[model samples]
Target: MRSSAVWRALPRGDLLLTSWPWRSLAYLITGVLLGEVVLLTFLATLFTGAILATVLVGIPLLLALALGGIPVAALERRRLMIIDPEPVENPHRRPERPGAREWLLLRVREQATWRELAYLVLLVVLLWPVELLAVVFGLGAPMSMILTPVLRAQTGDVRVLKFWLVTSDAEAFAALAVGAVWLALALYPLTLLAAAHGTLARAFLAPRESETGQRLAEITRSRTRLVEAFEAERRRIERDLHDGAQQRLVALTMTLGMAKLTEGAETAELVGRAHEQAKLALAEIRDLIRGIHPQILTDRGLPAAVADLADRSPIPAEVSVALPRRLPEAVEYVAYFVVSEALANVAKHSGATRAAVTGRLDGDLLVMEISDDGVGGADPSTGTGLAGLADRVSVVNGKLMISSPVGRFTLLRVEIPCAPTDHSK
Candidate 1:
């Protein structure tokens, strides 16, 4: 009878404890530690912000570093998906050359910055209070212990302020029971647990309106980078022309002029050298144009595009191409680039007997896979190759996955949403 009465009068936690008797210990530990975990998470964000600020300097470096957060913020969102047990959506992608200065400047200048900032701000707001409380809860009790002696003496009597409700010696003893609800602010442990859960949900679980904006921003940024890459490549080609073909042409023209001043075997040799230089210059020009846009791709679409690729490989390429008619230009362009880059990686890195490129249109997606049976250990983090592929996929609102374990085949897969027909039209 006493045990039952004791249980009944116990704080609500006793009922909860009995229900999860097996997990009660674990729950207590987690509950007590919750606030500390929240505190650490908030500190991590502040640390990241500080790190970015400290590392960034000047206009270019600062802009570049700030834009770098787009990817990290996107990663943070993905982490939330797994931890929050909610759907993980796409992450933010910003231009390699995103505009703006401070967050306020960038928020007005670039939507992606605003989106990324909103996510960070919301996450911090959600975390800071929880973290602060958790820190307070975890530490406050001990701090309170230090003050208890002083508080006791100041009162002159051990008077319980409203704790007088425990009129009976038994009730007062019960209320002050060690490790029980009647003990010092015993309600706090439960409050701390709920706060921790809410903090985790806010920081890592819940997807927000900003996630959608981030996805759009990533696409926009990737597109801008790709265009910038194209321009940069063009500039490189122009530089090569000025240095190689242009110089060669000038030398060839000068040699022909010199040949006119002589008429012997040496003059004949001079004309031959000029002719050879002209051929070399022509070859360089072809290579430069190919870099701009493989003319075959523009003329005959992807099959011929990849065929030109396969035909040139030192190691033979087995190519398989399929499509459901044609796709929207946006999807097709990304699909082509993904295949091109994947093949380039295979040719450069993969020690394969043979390679294959496959393309097919599935539902509203243009799915393409390029594979090579090679000495493999392909990781996304290993190089800029897969990162570039990811950016390409991002630009087209697509996904890219790479699988390569040691001694297995390396496969690069790309999927981009495509429409066979436009509804708005």
Candidate 2:
């Protein structure tokens, strides 16, 4: 993997042959040009807006000037890619809704907006000119000297950068050799300066450390919401199937059974078959409801749910969960499914005679492990089921670890950080 910073990407002892030095020079040159433009535009708009403030015409102009850094910083970010291949994330958060008022309000309120403005001010007043000078002296002078031989041949007598006269080919070639040496030495500082400039831009323009953390927190919260929503929808479907379809199927089965008992010998067999089909349909619906979101898991929590799974597993399974109380619904749901799937995998593939599931709340973490004594090689890549389970665990900021060495026991472990629910509730 490539390092995000260009300085880190630079190969040691190969400055001349690599593209980094050229990229640095280009980055500096562009910064200089961009800075000059920003400075001129800034002054023009700022003073004009100030002068016209009383007239009401300048109000919009001032607002524009205030938010001007957004576009400027956006350009800078794009330019930053030249020297720093690392992505510079914009610190600004999206508005909750799309509207000019919301956008401007959010921008004005955000610390990132003000930070960008400060960066623009710094760039206009100080940084860009410094970069300009460095590029001119560091890269420009050496390049000019390297062209010494060409200049002397063209003019027969040429003043080298107006510093010295070079009339002879020998003198020009000597200057060329010196310039080559100078260029090699100059590239180091050039790269360093560009790297520094990129770092400075990043400091003000990129998201702050706290902001990054906040974004991560927001993402976690949003993911949790999505998971909650998904679970609720599943439960809704389960309720519909259990109450509506299952009730109708049960009534049909009872009616057919009664018909079989009451009917003559000619119709008895037909009614019996119809009654059996209704019962099967009713059973299947119940299974579908359980698969969607088991009511037992909801009512009795994880311990009982694991026990239920153990009782149903084709392979002999033991459950030992030491939770004294219920956990959050999402946590219980995820844990239950992980154990259920692990046992299913064991029964189907592991040839395991016995499987054990253990769960306990250790500190804030809900820890669950499933182990099977069988020929063991569990690879999530071979099937989507395990991969999907892993994703489900991650949605709650949990981790899934699978240790299934070939010809050994397969152990699947999961840890989720959450405060246990108050059983009193």
Candidate 3:
């Protein structure tokens, strides 16, 4: 049912009855018109730019000539829909930042822009002329022969397609009958040629697979940056609470304790109560700050961070992380969280008495494993939060593997690619 069905419909008997032939004609005709306009514009611009090159006034004109393919390719893609119903995706990437300068710079650097320029040059110099010839010989000659009888009737003689002389009524009628058959057969090749042209246009105009991969990589890098920024903001908030609010609470608790020593029994009891509340609030804020971002991790890096996580776990846990140097901040951050989440899962679900966290560097990779002697059947699908951990690891292009068979042990392993940042302090 689609216009692109022309290829399949060609061998069918009912092709002439379908809209494909008319659509093919439209495609070729428009191509010729567009080609003429492009040719004229290119010539005029090239001549003017060359003449004014010495005055430096021709630079913008030359730039416009180079970028002219963008609009032409866009229009050609739209016109391609006459015989191709499937839409062609625009291959150009958006500028990293908004503005004409950024857009122009990006476009000039992209391979797609140059490819489009090549297509425009081919369209004007080559493809359009072939399309024009197809229309003329495939449709024009047959129609002229078919109209022979009408021409002979008005003038008493006619030249059929300038090839055959129709001097009698019988001759003119014979040409008309033959022309009808010729036109019917000509439509088949006409539709085929149009489809071929559409295929060529798509090949030139659509984004290549490598370009798509590059765009995907760009997106991943952008996501990584956002994640790093978010982690930085978390650290900032934690620092502010620890340095600003927590210190104020500590000073207030000290003052309350001093007041309790000097006051009468009733006043001293009230001061003691106030001092206890201040201490409790201070403890809660410390826990909150740790949860937001561990200051220990910032100071001592990943090994210390993992050790701290093991220390804070409810179950008995041991840590052994040996690295030659510090890792990148983002990799360290993701690794720390992965270990934290894994230990939490172990504590909450694993019926284990003891757990161990071990880490080592395998070349450029940071490999960490947390294992426990527990009844273990961990399924990410069971809402155990392992899926979230997997997502977090993937943000840094890391892998997470789990081995938790029933009644054996649970082992959570994560490997992240990273180069050493600095020698371990």
Candidate 4:
């Protein structure tokens, strides 16, 4: 169905009239050029890196060589557009942090990176040379024979393919006819070769079926975590309402009933007590609502909300959040809870005098760090909120990192993507 589908176009009667042959020719030609450059670069870098390995100066060059396939594969994928209309998706995953080190570590660990290296090696050592030969024999030989008449006319006689000699105009014209037929037939094979090459490139460059399945599994796990977190949160809210505000409301009702059944000074005292109970119940309900989703977060965004959290923390907590713009509501919501839960942990478990919450936008990531000068042997397995925090973060495709030395400090760092996510998934 694709207009650029070379395999489909090969069987058509108008194959020669279409642009498929020219496109295939261009693709193969460019591939040969690219392969030559890759070969030279690979050899030079390998030799230099090997010579300088003792001094460690070539370590980076060697690393670059290892990662060289990434760029080569990217260019080849683009070149494939000449014959393959289907786009090849890059199989690399985004690094959790914004750094060259993190990016390099992630790339080296991915199977896609190694596959690309294999593809590059095959392309330079085998594929390009074969393509060069195909182009030369399939296209060049026929064109040369077709030009035999012109050569004979220019001089006295011409040799077709350096074998058959053509002296008279009739012999030259006969060679030309044969050459035309050969050229016409050769195009089909050439186009098919290009299509085969594209398929190989795609197999190496695009995400494999297994990788796609793994990604789907990861998404399913993250979604399940999100669902479990939501359920736990709902239960917490229910518990808080039942044990705090509902109990207070019931007491307030009882106090009012007692006041109505009494008289005079007793009545006034009971009414006054009932009014205080009613106010306490209202305050408890408001606190519960705020705990669920703070009004300040919805109104003024993350900075204001975090600053409010700092003000409310039992310890002297410093807040420094500077965002370029308001983030997606879900991101802000998750960020707020991460800070809230982190601060609560600090207050309850850290035994620290002070804590700080800092946030900034590192490229497209929202990087947040909560640090405290506490006796820090914080363990996620110790029934603390760190595991819950990690689960919550994973729901938004974010990362949670914790650093806590036995007697040092605890630092909770979270990196979340700034892009909006479909949480419904």
Which candidate wins on lDDT?
4
Candidate 2 structure quality by residue, lDDT tens digits, 331-415: 8888988898788889889989999999998988999999999998788778725666776787787877777789998888888
- Flag the better candidate by lDDT, 2 or 3: 3
lDDT of 1 at 376: 82
Per-residue lDDT of 159 in model 3: 81
Poorest stretch of ten by lDDT in candidate 3: 93-102
Please give the range of 10 consecutive residues that has the lowest summed lDDT in model 1. 1-10
What local lDDT score does residue 89 receive in model 4, on the 0 to 100 scale? 74
- Give a tens-digit lDDT track for model 4, residues 235-286: 9999998999999989989999998899999999999998899899899998
- Model 1 lDDT tens row, 344-412: 888778888888888887777777888899888776567747776787677666877776779988877
Quote the lDDT for 99 in model 2: 51
The lDDT per prediction is 0.60, 0.83, 0.84, 0.88
Best by TM-score: 4
**Candidate 2 whole-model C-alpha lDDT, 0 to 1:** 0.83
Q: What ranking emerges by TM-score with the best candidate at the front?
A: 4, 2, 3, 1
Each prediction's RMSD over C-alphas, in Å, is 21.0, 20.3, 20.6, 6.8
Instruction: In angstroms, give how far residue 412 of model 2 lies from its true place.
Output: 44
lDDT of 4: 0.88
lDDT-wise, the better of 1 and 3 is 3
lDDT over C-alpha atoms for residue 253 of model 4: 90
